[model samples]
Target: MRKLTLLIPILVIALIGVLSSVFVVDEREKALVLQFGQIKAVKEDPGLSFKIPLIQEVVKYDDRILSLDTETIEVTPSDDRRLVVDAFTRYRISDVVQFRQAVGVGGVRVAEDRLGSILNSQIREVLGADQVTSDTILSEDRRELMNRIRNQARDSARSLGIEVVDVRLKQTNLPEQNLNATFARMRAEREREAADEIARGNEAAQRVRALADRTVVETMSEAEREAQVIRGEADAKRNGIFAEAFGADPEFFAFYRSLQAYEKALQGSNSSMVMTPDSEFFDYLKSDRAAK
Candidate 1:
């Protein structure tokens, strides 16, 4: 019984050692065994684990992708435009050994701080290369331009033992003081363009009116010339006919013309007076009387 009692105490100590050495790996964590403040082994799989009792230490690291939302950063473009840009990055630990060496058990914050610096330089480089004036980055091409900025940042971050999965711009806007200035400039430019268009329209209208006046004057001159020629031809033809008729019989034509004149003059008269009866106008009457 005394030998049994001594064996029981040894078993108890062994059980205590086993309990202290026992460890577990969760689904969201990676286990790193450190001995004497030096990394001994890395365990990635999730399961029960063990370490040297009271001599080694187990540290857990999150292996999942981490998200970092940086604050809105104000930047200036090459074209002298002020802008505020908010951004976010997706990253994960790539080199656990380098990570541990570079930073202690602070998993994502170490990477995040380094990434912020990279993003700052890259954002300046990218937007500095572009030409966005105060307003905003509103188009697809602008978004792509920002993505290229993130790409450069990712490359810079690789040396820090982290891989950038994605980067996105949450918002972009102009500073308070520059907002009204930008709008005013744009409005002035548009108004100037409109005024220029109106001036051009007036010039076009004047040109059209001048062309129409020239065409109308030319057409009217041509019509007047044709009409005068036709009138002259008609007058010449009538003169020729009258001369031939008058040359055919002079006395008969004169007598017939005098009779036509008397007929026309005597029809409108209610009273008539005879002036000596030998008047030349009575020739038609005297000749008629002789004929009777």
Candidate 2:
């Protein structure tokens, strides 16, 4: 029974050792076997793997693509316009051996931090180039610029065993202070345009008013000229009638004229006129008295 108990303990230790020596890697992971802090093997496929128990250690990394979002950075384009840029990267560990060597025990977090710095540098370089402007950044050409940044970042990330699948600028904006200033300038421009429009309207109104006034003056002058012509014609017709009457009978015409003169001279009550008895104006009165 004692010998059996001793054998049982040995079997239990063996089982523990076996369990510790064997490790399983999932399809979504890549693992590195480190012996005394030195890489011994890289396991990429999903399956059971063997290593020395208590002497070797396995470090696992996600083989799938990962995302790293960089902090917002400031970039000035060729037009001297400054913008805050936010970017992100899609990457994966292509070479686990090199990745393990580069980052040591820091793992994916440290790798992403370093990669973010490279991405930020490339973003600034590409976006701040002489040919790039704020308009370009906000245009369809922005995709091409991001591709350039991705390519450059890929090159820089090679030493770290990182494959940059893509780099994209997520957002870009002006600073608060600049935004306010831009709004102010736009308002001023709008106001100036409004003033110009008002000036043009006033000028048009003045021209219309002047035209109307000229038309009125011409109409009034034409009316006055027509009235004068009508008055002159009427006066000529009346003088012709008077001449015909006078040619018909001089005495009757003279007597009629004298009666008109009397009526005009004695138009109001209590009116009197002093005249010589032989005056032609009194001829009618004298003849009437003599006949009676």
Which residue segments of model 1 deviate by more than 4 Å?
A: 1-29, 34-38, 45-48, 52-58, 125-160, 165-172, 251-292
lDDT, candidate 1, 162-255, per-residue tens? 7888888888888878889989999999999999999999999999999999999999999999999999999999888767778997777777
Q: Tell me which residue pairs clash in candidate 1.
A: none
Give the true-structure RMSD of model 2: 4.3
| Top-TM-score structure, candidate number | 2
The regions of model 2 sitting more than 4 angstroms off are 208-292
Model 2, 1-292: lDDT tens digits are 9999899999999999999999999999999999999999999999999999999999999999999999999999999989999999999999999998899899998999999899999999999999999999999999999999999999999999999999989999988779899899999999999999999999999999999999999999999999999999999999898899999987778778988988888877788778776776666677574475
Report residue 34 deviation for candidate 2 (angstroms).
1.5
TM-score of each: 0.67, 0.75
How much does each candidate deviate from the true structure in C-alpha RMSD?
5.7, 4.3
Task: Kindly state the number of residue pairs that clash in model 2.
Answer: 0
